[model samples]
Target chain A: MDTFLQVLIAGVTMGCIYAFVALGFTLTIAAAGVVNFSYSEWVTYGGFFGVTLYSIVGLPLWAALIGTVILCVIMGYVFQWVVFRPLEGRHFLTIVTATIGISVSMGALATLVWGPYPLTLPTFFGNGTVEFGGISFFPHNVLIIVLAIALISVLQFCLTKTDIGLRLQATAQDPDAARLMGIPVRRMRTFAYCLSAGLAGLSGFLVAPLFVVTTTMGFGLMLKGLAATIVGGWGSLKGAVFGGLIIGIVEALGAAYISSEYKDVIAFLIIIVVLLFRPRGLFPERIAEKL
Target chain B: MRILSKSVIAAALAMSFAQVAFADDIKLGMVIGTTGPFAGGEAPLVNGTKMAVEDINAKGGIKGNKIQLIIEDTGSEQTGAINAYNRILDQEPSAIMNTTVSGFVLSQMGTIGDEGIPTLTGAASAQLALDKKGVEPLFRVRTSDLYVAKAAARFAIDNLGGKKIAVLRANSEFGNSWLNQIQSVLTDKSVKPVAVESFEVADRDFTPQILRIKDAGADVVIVSGDPPHFVVAVQQLKQLGLTSKVIFSNAGVLPTTIKLYQGDSANGIYGTVDSVPAIDPARADWAKRYREKFNIDSDYSAAEYYDGVMMVAAAIAKVGTDHEALVKEMRTIKDYAGIGNTYSYADKGDGGRSVAIVQIGDGKLTLAATIK
Candidate 1:
């Protein structure tokens, strides 16, 4: 039972990180007809940003997070204007290739800027632990779970309750129609990129305490998020979030019970099994992109 | 008859010219990691080897002849390592150095012996590397993984006063070696393992393994794997409030490991290391010069690989262009002082296996003591 609880906590924390990255995937797909493969870079941005502020410059923990998120949002706009905007009416392959190019460039940029060393962030919740009913929990783990849930709620509200939300829905549904109705589809796409990157930045910030901030850190997380998106039902926010949790839990259970050596492999194996059985995904596939 | 003889002489001269064009240079094949999950483990060696080459050449090189190291990335995987070794063998380097994979070293040894190339690398952890007749053509530069485990066990028993211990290992050469070495030592000391948990290297979640360890009422957790496994285990340990001390092998206690745990949780951790980070007053000048050149602190991985390359240079210089002679002399280098360490390569068939222990205190990686 204690072992079960331990795996459960690890799964939830890891799943939360995946969910945060997945949230970025869902938002970008919803707002733009193209999935931004470069969303993973935002997580790296968040981590490096936090490391600079908190470890090097010695900012308060919360301030570093906020600053990193803001920088990530701006960086998303830079990508949109510099790379995504130019390919507005190009072939899907062109757009995809361009995003891949962006990813490669960002990866190199990360390597050049940070060197190839791993970095750790200061623990925000202190080095304390809480034990309840024979199960113990790290303070950071609890804090991150709370933060992920809160961000989900906040993002959901912004998507449903704001004027921008209506414009975003109209753009995603039919960019031509949205434009005819004065929705400014291009601006909406840029806005989505900003929102997506903000979430990734947040994910990076929270997970920095757990994993060192390395150039390769975000790529793995991004791939995991992509897997989550596919398993939860392609392009569905609900599905992506759900899929992230599933991947995280499967990894924990596999590491705990099956084999620790294949913990990472287990996450992908579960995704494969889900995909083999449900071609459309565990949930209804949402139309995140349109021709 | 005179006209035919003159034509034959001209043909012979042309044939000799063609032979010179296609002659093979003395290529030193190397399996240095350029990318992948384990890239950090071996990148320093490549850079430091280059520095060693320059330093040697600064003194007019090996017998006034320039040495070349033909390096290829091992990709930090088994298949990648195999492919790299096969390609490097095609070039037929006079000597080779394989990076940090025990399996790769053993696998490539047969080919190395067949090809008649002497390989010096710190990556292989097997004792069999020293067993020449049936060994790989490669020699290990660092302590054998067997020695590392013994050092870990010694540190646990002698310093940490650990009697009952828990073992957490990844299912790799590193982990397997650690488990075998420590298990034997623990048995000799009559300390039964409280619990044993194994995980895959790729597995990020360690909750199940940690929980099993906690349930077994262990006093210390000995880990043998890459930094990620160690980080995940340490983070999960803190999360579960399981304060059983973590005892990691040398590779387990890399600088990257402390960075993974945010330096705070790294406190109170004990592990074996290859070399001290040259911070002592005795080695401060060396550290300062290395940092000034590379913008990074000097580590044992670099120091030892640098020594290996220099040792190769010493042999090559003595033999005066005889590759076979260099290999023979590499085994008999007597009492040569290097970087404050003695090097006399004993063909007892493996290079010496030695270790040091380090303690993480106040978020800094500090040298504790030398563990034999």
Candidate 2:
């Protein structure tokens, strides 16, 4: 039972991380209708940025995270203008290839800037443990998990209940129709990029507490996020959250109950199995009827 | 086969082209990870080897010839390693220095076994590389995981007196070799493990594993994974308030793990390190030289590969480029003072190999005792 609880907490904590990373994926897909494959690089950028500001430049931890996210935002805008912006109106495949190229470039740039060594961030919550009703979690993990949930809730609320959120959702659903309704499509897409970059930053900040801040850290998270997107249904905000958390929990449980070596592989297999059965997802997006 | 035919033709052409009054610099083949997972170990290794060649020429050219190291980044894959070999072979390098991951080395082991290239590996410590299945002609300048695991196990049993241990190994070849070497040693000593399990190299959480160890009455945990993977395990161990001696293997060389574990939590943790971070003034002087050379804090890699370059240079001096002759010369190396270890290559690929148990006593590794 104790083992079960520990695995649960760990799964949720990491699943939250996978969600934030996948949320970045979901946002870009929603706003631009293109899966920005470079999403993982943003997460990696956040980690490298965290290392520089926190370790090298000696900024406060909180400021470092904020600074890293700011950089992530700037990078997103730059890549949009420099790479994705130029390739617009081309085939979706072209855009995806460009995004992949951008990802590789970002990885190389981060590699050059930080060197290939995995950077270390100071444990944000210290080396403290919190015992809750006979179960325990690392204090830092609790912080990450809470932050992920709160941010996810805030995202859902803003999307379903706010004015800008509606405009953004309109833009995602039908950019041409949204533009006819006075929504600036380009701005909305850029907004999505910025939002995606921020979410990636948050994911990296959360994971940095758990592991070393390596340039390659985001690759695994990105793969898991891809699994999340597929399982949750691409561009469905709520589904991304649900699917990401499910993927994380299942992966953790699989590692515990089955072979840990096949943890990542198992998650992908589950996504494939899910796709074979329910091609859309466990929770498909609702279609509004025009009576 | 086509590439090889082309390579042979190119080598012959290059030899013929050399005498056309255009003396192209002698190309020394170099292979190391330029990208992918094991690039961490490969990058610094290449950097040091390149720096050594530069230093040699800065003082004086090698035998009135400027040595040119022609590098090919083997992308941590067997196909890449073979391509690198073919490309460098076409360039007519006198010898090849390879950068390969564990499984990739075994993949090329046959090539070196049949071809008898005087190959030197910067990394890849799978036991099979040195086992009977390995290419007889292959040799590692870098210490094998066999010696590393042996050193770690010997330290735990002899110094830490750690019995009732928990073994947490990663799923990779390096991790499997670590578990295999340690388990055999423990078995010989009649010490049974509390629980043995495996984790993937990219496993993010280890709490379940830790809790299992806690329940099983494990007093010590021997973790074998990459630095990031092992760091999570150690940090998780600390979070669980499990103060059992968390002795890590060679993977503990990453200083980032110490930082992630917070201040002084890594102090009592033992490892078979490359650098005795605490050493007499002589070793400190070597560290100073290393720091000045690399403009970074030197770790086990800096010490280990610096020594490896010197050993390979000694081999060159003793046998002068004959593959069998150099291998024989390396076999006779004895008590040679190396930056990492002071010894010679044994009959197998392990020469000049010595493993020592070092502990982080005051935020820096100090020699606990030699595992002689």
Every candidate's DockQ is 0.34, 0.47
Tens-digit lDDT string for candidate 2 (A11-117): 89878888888888888777777778888788987887888899888999999988988988887888778876787667878888888887777776776777766
| Candidates' chain B TM-scores in the order shown | 0.88, 0.85
* Residue range B1-372, candidate 1, lDDT tens digits: 999999999999999986763343446668866665566677677767877777876777665556677888776667788789888878767677777666766666667677767777776455455553334345557666677778888777788787679989888777787888888998889988887788765456667787778777887788877776677766677777777777777665655456456547678787777666555577677667777887766777777777788788777766744557777788786555554244555646456545788887765667777875
For model 2, residues B273-323, the per-residue Cα lDDT tens digits are 644532646678766776677666566555655566566666765566666
What TM-score do all the candidates reach, one by one? 0.83, 0.89
Compared with the true structure, what per-residue lDDT tens digits does model 1 show for residues A1-291?
766876787798888888888889877777777777777777877898988888787889989988989988998888888888888878877887878777767766776677666677867767667888877887888888898888878777777788998788778777898999988888899899888888888888887777667666787788889888888877677777799899898988887777665677777877888889987788754463242
Per model, state how many residue pairs clash.
Answer: 12, 6
In candidate 2, stretches whose alpha carbon ends up further than 4 angstroms from where it belongs are A257-273, A286-291, B1-26, B76-79, B124-131, B255-260, B274-282, B318-337, B342-349
How much DockQ does model 2 earn? 0.47
